[model samples]
Target chain A: MKATPARDQETVDKWEVQLRKGCLELAILAALWEGKLYGLEILRQLESDSDLIVSEGTVYPLLSRLKVLGLVKSEWVESEAGHPRKYYALTPAGKKRALEMAGIWTRFSSSMGKLLAPLGKGNK
Target chain B: MTMADDVQQRDAQQSMEAYLGRLRRRLRGMNDEDAREIVEELRSHIRDKAAASGQVTASGVDAALAALGSPEELASQYLTDDLLARAEVSRSPVRILESLFRWASLSVAGFLVLLGSMVGYFLGVVFILVAALKSFHPRTAGVWVLPNGADDFNISVRLGFGSAPLEGREVLGWWIMPIGLAAGCALVMLTTRFAIWCVRQYRKSRALPRG
Candidate 1:
């Protein structure tokens, strides 16, 4: 690893945190783009697919909010193994919103990549 | 030994119960039914996560609990989120203020909105009081235009306790009652609306302001 100042690293960490906070909703919604899943399943999916780790505590409350906004709906499904699991699925409005967000994200990332192209070349 | 494993297993169960107990206590003030539902759901999640690890040890369960953060923290998040959702659909001042108080714990924006509402409501009450008290003390319970005070000329609202000020002129006569009542009601209404507007704007994003 290259030597870097701790303060610089802290600043980078803060920006990454900000980025993660903004994308968390999209990430959760995208995870449900497949099908209904329980809380732990969502967590595992995010962990396996991306480095966008979140404290597990934040997920359920967010799911509740999404429900309130009519973006998602949940149901209690009985399980043979243990207690019933609460499975959440995106609603029609949620799917529409996710598509719109994904479009915006695609354009924004390409723009950012183009802007950073010079930096990449300089590093080489 | 089997005995040691039994002790560890008992300890693990106790830890989980203790954690759930703390969570239940923190979830107070929310509807009992809703709070109980949340706690049970969380309880299930913890059990499932812990079981997935294939160990029943205290450390294993604790790890699962830790992944969910502290009981208080999770409870507060749930409370804030619930309050905000309710506040969105509700026009009740009491309910809105309750939600703002919950949000105030997390963000500077929320704290400021709550403060503004409190100050507005306080002033509204004071205005109504001044108006109501005017009927009782017509002589002094009106707006006073003191041309000169100990420092500068001061305009004040007084309830006329002992003496109407030595040289201060009482303005508005009987009109003060109507003015005070109207102004009081207006302040209360304006404050409520402003607070609700702020709540609506901030509700879309719950992340704390740049810290």
Candidate 2:
């Protein structure tokens, strides 16, 4: 019996969602590792600083999740030109977790690179 | 700012408020503090973007909102993130209890809990209800003074159970049942309010953002 590989739009979309879901937490943590930024600022920074293109809506909730986990802390400071903005920064725990995640990500990506190298050369 | 610019800014501000209001309505079960934080952040972001693009106007506000995506989509994102985080955390009995309390009205959560093979929910419900009812049960400790030789009158405070006489002259401890009933009612009210409070606190504690 032969099994057919399903490459339907639904399947592709599912895969993409999973992929995005996995990386989003990492992207958010890394963005905060540099400095404090509010919800939208974090989204813009992620978009500009990395290959991660995220919608503004998703970022706020993710920030809430991170804060819940105690990996991030936020405070409101009155802006010079406008109202107070909730700026988020990494906690000590968050910094350690981010560092650990970065290390794991590095190894995983490097291993994936090696695994995909042969395919990359053959496609050329 | 000129009058025309003021009108444009006001129009833009109104649009932004409407957008945020829509978002707030979409985030129904979300904790109030978190919702407020989300709203304020988005507001500032919109204003900042508008300023960067030169003067706040309805068009600028529209563009900023378009970039953010729809309110429903945004709410679903928050919900997905919340569920994922919740799944990751160790489901201690307390957390599970809180979750059940939080989603008691939602059939989906009840279904999921049942599917998760946790018989503890039944135990939790039974425990909560029994405990609450027990509070209303009048019991007395120490001396319960009552009418002498009253065959119908008996008083015991053993283990939250109480006995009382119908009539007594020098009734020293005749007040146990009424006091117990009152205490019980209070306990029931407090228990319900505590359950609600626990759910809110759980949600609030899930993200305190240091502010």
Candidate 3:
């Protein structure tokens, strides 16, 4: 039996959900580690660098939660566009945590890659 | 406007306003201009989508929202990972403690209320009977009052197995016992109702789609 378009879309959506759930934190941290950025700038950076599709909704809540935890501090900066942008910077603790997360992510991805290696070889 | 036109216009307007309201709330503590700009950008995107679709439907609103995701998650991406970690840690401990306290307190209070009501009902019935016998017989009054009163008497009764008093009067004044019983019933009813409301609110909040 052929998979319907809706069923295929549902499968893709589930995969996207899992992917987003797993890596969203790491992606956000990596984006902010470089320099202070506003929400839009961060969104743009994530899309450009990792091809990770994130919604504005996901980013905002995570930021608030982070701020409450005292990991990141935000400041309103006057912009040329006449809007004061909220720029987020990593605290000292944030930087240390980011490094740790990066290490963990590297180990996890490499392990997963190795596990999938057999499948790719078998297909070939 | 025609009925269809009116409905479509209203829907588009409502959707735009709702998104803007959410965006504004999400961007609280940030600069207002930044928040407004974000809202405008989202509004324009939603309008464009609505125009392309030609008719406003629930699906259109959902699609527009899907494009935006939830405001909370959008803000989260701008936060540092350490912040997320801290939030996860800070929130869990406090919430767990709070829920634990709430459940424990409610359970104890409920048990006390139930026990108090049962005791109150027995006392109420006995009081009415004693008051009846005292007024009617007058002769066997001492007999009925003394022995029956001993059982109904809420003096501190120590059980052999327990360290605490098994039976005791809550109020010092015997006259106030009825009032205390009424108050206990009221307290239990109010607490049960509040607990139910809280459960409903929890369920409702959970039912909401998260980002």
Candidate 4:
């Protein structure tokens, strides 16, 4: 007996989910690297810049966790159109973490790219 | 504004409130102020998301809520994250275990830490109990290194009945009380410190899906 393609795809999806979970902290930290942004703005930055589409509810808990770790800080500012919005900014520690994460990601992905280079050619 | 848009706005408001209501219910046992603040922040996020889409239609609200995912899961993540953060600093055994048990539900590292914690605390408790029983049942409730063979031995610590189960001499007759008490308290204190250190490490390493 052999596994189906769907099963293989399921395994890949599981890996994808875990990978995303691992990168979420780094991603949020990176999103706040430029300056303060409200929750929705952060989500939009993640989507537009990185093409990573995270579910909306996931970001809040993650932000809370970052604040607990002293990596990020937040404050509420009045919005002209609606309710006051909570804006998140990277703390000094968060900026340091973001730089460290970026370096790691760059190194990891570059090697990953080298490993994956052959598969892209389809020469075999 | 058209009457149709008015109706859609009202429906959107209802759906958002209903979602928040379920979230508030899930957060009931949490600190009221913290829970209220969470609800407030989420309310603002949802409204901000909906309004930013250029229309406050029911579908816009639906999209916002959908992006946010289920309120139940969201609330649980918030609770677990808060618990683990508090557990890192809290010195109380009950509070630490409460946090660890919840963490255990989510990760293997947490379960292992919790198992270590339980075993450490259990031994500490056993030592204290043996110390107390030394006064009541001096014949049985004490620690000893009973000789098992000519070259080997067994270290035994127990709370028993009748006569002592050992042929070898007891470790510390009446002095066992104060020694046991001190040793038990020390064990407990050391376990607490070790558990806190383990939790801090776990928090540092395990940074994914606080749910």
Best by the TM-score measure: 1
TM-scores of chain B, in order? 0.69, 0.45, 0.34, 0.65
Q: Weakest 10 consecutive residues, lDDT, candidate 1 chain A?
A: A13-22
Model 3 C-alpha lDDT per residue in residues B88-185, reported as the tens digit of each score: 46533333223323233333442343344445444444444433443343323211111225556533211112232333422323333344345545
Which runs of model 4 end up more than 4 angstroms from their true locations?
A1-3, B2-4, B87-92, B100-211
Task: Name the TM-score of candidate 4.
Answer: 0.71
Instruction: Assess the local accuracy of residue B88 in candidate 3 as a C-alpha lDDT between 0 and 100.
Output: 49
N/CA/C clash count, model 4: 2
- Model 1 per-residue lDDT at B183: 95
State residue A43's C-alpha deviation in candidate 1, in Å: 0.9
Q: Candidate 2, residues B69-137: lDDT per residue as tens digits?
A: 877656645654554456457544445444453344333533444334244333334334433444454
Write the number of the candidate with greater lDDT, choosing between 2 and 4.
4
Tell me which residue pairs clash in candidate 2.
A68-B206, B136-B184, B145-B173, B153-B165
Task: Provide TM-scores for the models.
Answer: 0.76, 0.63, 0.45, 0.71
User: What lDDT score goes with residue B68 in model 3?
Assistant: 69
lDDT of 2 at B157: 28
Per residue, candidate 1 scores C-alpha lDDT tens digits across B1-211 of 5998899888888889999899888777677887787777787788788778665677888988977778866776786677666756775768867777766765678789989999998888777888998888878787888877477788888876677787878888888788989999998889888986776565434443222
Lowest lDDT sum, 10 consecutive residues, model 3 chain A, at A56-65
lDDT by residue (A8-114, candidate 2, tens digit) is 66567556655665677888889888789777778778778876676565577778879878899999989975678889999999999999989999999999999
Stronger candidate by TM-score (1 vs 3): 1
Better of 3 and 4 by DockQ: 4
Per-candidate TM-score, chain A: 0.91, 0.87, 0.85, 0.92
